[model samples]
Target chain A: MTMAQMDRLLFGDNQFFGINHMSEEKARAQAMRFQKTDAIMEVLDVAYAEGIRTFMCTTHDRITEVADRVRADPVRYADFRFYPCMPYAHKYANAVTDHGMVGALRHFMPSDGVLSTALTGGRALATKEVDGIAKVLIDMEMKMFHGLQTPVIFVQNVFTDLLLGMGFTRALRIFHDHVVTKYGVEPAFITMNMPMLLEALEKEGIERPIICANINKIGFRMSGGFDAYLDALRSGRVRAVAMSVYASGAIPPDEAIHWISELPGVESIVFGASSAGNIRGTKALVDKYMGAPA
Target chain B: MDHKVRIGVVGLGKMGLSHFAMVNAHPQVETIACDGAGFMVDVLGRNLENTIYRDYDTMLDAERLDAVVIATPSRLHAPMTTAALERGLHVFCEKPFCLDWADSERLATLAADKARVAQVGYHYRYVGAFREMKRILDTGALGRITHVLAEAYGPVVLRPKRSTWRSQKSEGGGCLYDYAAHPVNLLNWFFGTPAQASGSVLTPIFSDGIDDQVTATLGWDEGPTAQLSVNWSDESHRKMTTRITMIGTNGRIFADRQECQVYLRAPDPALPGFEAGWTVKYTTELTEDPWFYLRGEEYSAQLADFSGAVAEGQGKAVENDFASAAQTDRTMAMMIENAETGQPVGAPPVTARPTPARKRGWFAWKA
Candidate 1:
């Protein structure tokens, strides 16, 4: 009922409490910036010192950069976690693809350009397009799910479908695809990509990886964006809810802070920042709301 | 008795009816003839004579009117006014002379060449509160304006919705074009043409590509800047009002229909504890008259001015030819286009939903 209770539920696990770092196309092009490895570790260290245990980046390219930079220094910063940009990779890829069952499979697959090219060009052993994309997705999950341990996916409006619309509990279990008919590997793992389905994994007494959601849905007012999430929380329909409170900047900071704190089952809210100024402002706001020591 | 002049009315929408009422009521003026969408002709036929013609050309040719009041569709406003001007008739066209800047400029140039009195329907200039603010600015009592925030909001009911004339992009019946005309015209009337405008446009409720909400930042000639918010998707049907706040070098003026307040921040003290902060120097509230004031005072004043202009050959009419109205129209058109395409279409880069420093404490806000 109180905000303190909700904050404890969300942040108590010491899961990745993070601030998003946005880099522009120009910034991305200039590979030579501040010592890439040391700079990233420095930011992770900053987040870690602020009671943050996990770190996440936005794009696949950014994630690869961080993953590559931290590859050698993995043990150097063992206390932190890395969240590769998988959600946007799926969404962006979907935006470009033609609509079909194969396209839907590709929507769940990873954003590795090499893997995507291999599937497209028939370089990889693909029985069919859907099977090919599903194989890539399965391989991706197996590859990263173990390394990252718990990966966070940012869903755009799809989270509502999983939670309130059709519960994905049964769908995750029934993975009778034509890919399995041809290949020996079963692709029941597609449910991991669905936010509500992944959340349900925890309730079924299966310890699934944690998924943080940053819902950047358009037409927040019309889609009943917040109302759906609020209804889910109030009805105890959702178990692991991460409140991306500031996704729509229309909601005032004070009101958002209050609502996030009072939501029944909200876990963590990932802070998005365009610049260091934004991070600083958010940090101040968080501190002000939590009654944390200034 | 003074020799009376004749004035013809065109496109009888709500504004057209106001013009008809004014023309009929005034003693010195004669309503020579008028034309609108057939509905207006029906509305006017009860009181006025059968001086109504369906087509503007027929009305112009048949009636020997000395001047004309144009309240036609935005796309036709420029052409209609231009035609009237060429016929040697003094013209008063509605706000947004053209849907775009180029068209507005062409109309402006045409009006300049003619020896006829021309003005756009920027009636807010004659509004009492605006008139008061103008006086305060002229007196230099408020000092130089540093920051200005002008807000205007109303439901879709203010402007009658038409299928062909309004809904069409060519006709210019979108949010920024229809509702925004008031604020844009007022902004131009209050301040000059904004050097550059950056803003976001949206159609949250309405299915049409027409915008329902818009927030814009206008950079002025001087260092002072302005933020304007105009919305048509307000909760209730009737939400008609324009609120303006101007922050000047010496003082700040906040004006709305309910109350108007002027704040003067006293100079801070050199010492810490004794430092003086901003203080409200003057506050005044106009008596709340019934809704009939719109029909009685505002409409009557505008009609009287138009009648006087027609009779005396010279009088202040609604500013249909003001350069600011044209720029405002251009800004609205550009904003609507920008909303349709994510790219900044001849407009400045604008964030769709920028983090507001202060909350829009409408019914949405709990506190």
Candidate 2:
């Protein structure tokens, strides 16, 4: 995905769910404040009002409510498209805790693929079929986002890092193929360690993969380092989605935007905000620094 | 003979050294130090004429100490604290208390059994602004608190390579244990244990398996709610910044290291010093310049309190004791579990509130 294809300022679900990098106190406050779907929609509406129509969000259970609310009001959300990030691992993890592993798979399996999925799930578990299980699980996760306009689906960092650590490079291919062949949209990967992930993706024959990672001036949470990230961006090999450009609230807004704007190949910047003021302010800053996203 | 509390400090890293300096400077306290790093022991031995050893056990055996300050990593906190308590020494372990809740619980039990002063270093509690906030809250100036927001942000672990023991999951690395402990302890200080907790996300911004960012919501049975957001990866904050905002029925209190702002809808006579409306108090007004201030007033105040407790034979009720610290650890564990499982990890849900009736017309309410 390129800058033109993706929204320069994509709204994120972290704020809606009370995810804050700096404060658990603030996160819990946000969670309670945005407990209702309407509260979440209010923030999304603020982002939309500020000309940010694309929402890069996770497939969290609450997001299904958001997708439903958006789908219900087609006129208002006419231009809205969800960059559905997937394998909200907590959802599956919770399901497995409540119900057994196979039971949880069955619970999430699509209606048409119930029997086949069950057989595949049983065999995969028994034989340790990592790729087969990954494919099935991806399909299962994509089930909630069935009718939404998901131009790009991302593998969340949890699973991405897991696969990366396990050296399960083949799983990335399975996700890419399924997202491309089945959904007809490109697949993206969210990771903390982007350099290694990008190299792995290239080795797997996936060229110019879209990878979202922490790309900031201070190298906050950048796995390799600022230099490596800069080198990767300058190399123009992988498409980069820069998140945490504010470095988890460390850098000043203008400086952060200006620094990131000058970087070579950052295709998009995804940020989370809880209020209209923050949404408007961030959008203006990005536009001022990045020059209206070309 | 000098009537002073003789204290031995173990794990002379960043926090240990700070404590050593504070205790050494106090007129009423004498200090000894130990660390696994021989160079650190040598450095402290050279500076202060106190006994310094590379091994904690050797130092404990060699020195006649009334108390021990344990500033080791979270994984080692429990063992060191238990050993000190068993040795009949008042123990002060740094924040996080321990890596696991079970271990913290065991340590708390040991401390209780030994009848020793066991304080966990939640230095924020001693900070002038937060202390003032706590005092105001105690006066019921804000009425019944409806919600609280605690935040701690810093750029300490911005890169993966900067990962220390704090970045390792086994060693209690990440913002959750290292940074979140402050806000978690603050929340528990304001309100007792949360009745229910959910919607947790532990994000590893730079390193896998190391949570650089943590968010969670805690609900109290008495209607108060709390939110915690801590990100060690935030580069915007030059240093770790902690802020707590409490929304109460009658007013609000927003406090950080710099200042405390309290807003009241109506002045309560119960809170004598506070006015009816908004009041902003700066830390400069509340803080006192200590004779030997090295880190901050809060750090000095905490060490002074620990030393005083030892001197007066009143170390048993040092405010931030192991029991309370263990409660914070338990809540944190629940939040982490909730984040991992995507489920509510605390007590069973209370009865749901009734949904409000939908509006029929703009004038419906007036009519």
Candidate 3:
């Protein structure tokens, strides 16, 4: 995925779902505030009005309602497209708990891959076919975004790091191939440990894999440290999407944007905001620093 | 009649040997030992009168063990625990429970089904200073805690060493999982599950792929916000230095290995002998020196708890059970996710407090 194709400022869904890393009180309040789809839409509308057309969001259960609402009012969301991140693992875990494993798999199996996926899932579970299980699961996760424009599909960090730790590089290839072949979208892996993940993906014969990781000053949560990340960016060995630009409320906004703008390979910064003012403020800062078009 | 719990110790590494010594010292326990390293197994065989085997499975097959303590590298934790649990043996495995949350969850389920006294080795919880802190918090003297800060720093892995499993990420290397687990588990123990978290993992100060430092913020839906900062690269300290500070509406409590300090804004009857201002209590003041305080009291305390639970036959909920360890795993996962995604990864809130019933009209206050 190239910088031009992805909007410099991509809106994220954590704020709407009541996720605030710095303060649980605020997170709970926001979650209560946006419990309804309309409340989420109102915030999304504010972001949309402020010129953020790309919504980079997890495949949260509530997000489907937002997607349906957006789809219904095409005129309002005419330019909106999704950057769907997948394997909302908690959803799957809960599904498995409520239903049996096979029943959960059936519940999420796409219409196109129902039979094949079911057979593959069963065989994979029984025989420990890692690639087969991964392929079916990715397809199942993409079912919610069937009619949407998903130019980039992310493997959320939870699953991505798990694969990295297990050294299951083949699963990365499977995700890449299936996303490209079936959805015709670029595959991106989100990981807390970026340098190691980048090397892992490259080892799997994936050249310049799109990786999203924590990149900020203070090296806040950047694994391998900030200098290593800077070296990787300067080397141009991979495509990078910078998240946690604010260091989860640590760095000031202007300094965050200014520091990130000077970085070599970061193509986009994903951020979440609960109010219109914060949304517009962040957008203005990105436009100022990154020269993102209004 | 001999009623001592028959136990096996696996992976005679630093922790394994320590646990073996503790188990041997316990009057209520008899121990067998195993290690992949033949020399370590031989040494253990010579040192202890207990049986010794090079392979863990062979020991399990040959010996009748009531319980087992696994001190293997993190990658082996899940498999070893599962194998022991399958054989109907209670287990006390070392920290980071498993490298992956999926494996941890699976083992948790198995342990639950088998009704085994499974516990993760988070020895810091058994420290006297922290136990006193827990006692204070449990008394509600802290009064609606608002924030908790946990810091652990040391020079454990200060230089580049030969590639061991601890230096490899796939093998659960790094301070993030190993050293940071103490503070993370402590936070979970002190404030329950966080509603959300975000942080960064830093590495390569000493080794590659193994994270040497981690800084994270864990937020609860209502109670307290928590922050953790751990570094295994600090060269000033010879051993790990851990400190936790809890901020509450009425007071703040700070604790470490040696001492605990409490500052209260107002006097509460809940805390006897503690006045409205500041109070300092050392660990020496709190806990009596034990009979076999050789490898630290916390380690002995955890083993004693595990032994008691094993003796009980039914799985009793211990402080650091598989489920609690899994909660730490989930929090670590969220921290990693937040660090990578730059968004605060959300967790389910702690039990939601009931909204107070409001009386209607102007006479509500009077009523």
What's the TM-score of every candidate structure?
Answer: 0.47, 0.54, 0.53
Off by over 4 Å in 2: A1-294, B348-367
Model 3, runs deviating above 4 Å: A1-294, B347-367
Give the alpha-carbon lDDT of every model: 0.51, 0.78, 0.77
DockQ for each numbered candidate: 0.01, 0.01, 0.01
Task: Write candidate 3's Cα lDDT for B1-367 as tens digits.
Answer: 2588999888876577667766765667887878885333532344345677889889998998898999998899989998999998899999999878888888888899888898999988888788999999999987888778899998766666656677787888888888888898888888766788866555567686668888988888877777788998896553577889998878999988766889989878898988998997766446543323333557767887888888877585477999889888888888888877887788644645634547565655666
> The CA-based lDDT of model 1 is what?
0.51
lDDT accuracy of residue B278 in candidate 3 = 96
Model 1: per-residue Cα lDDT over B119-165, one tens digit each: 77666665555665665566655656768887877655233332445
Which candidate's TM-score is highest?
2
User: At residue B359, what lDDT does model 3 achieve?
Assistant: 50
lDDT of 3: 0.77
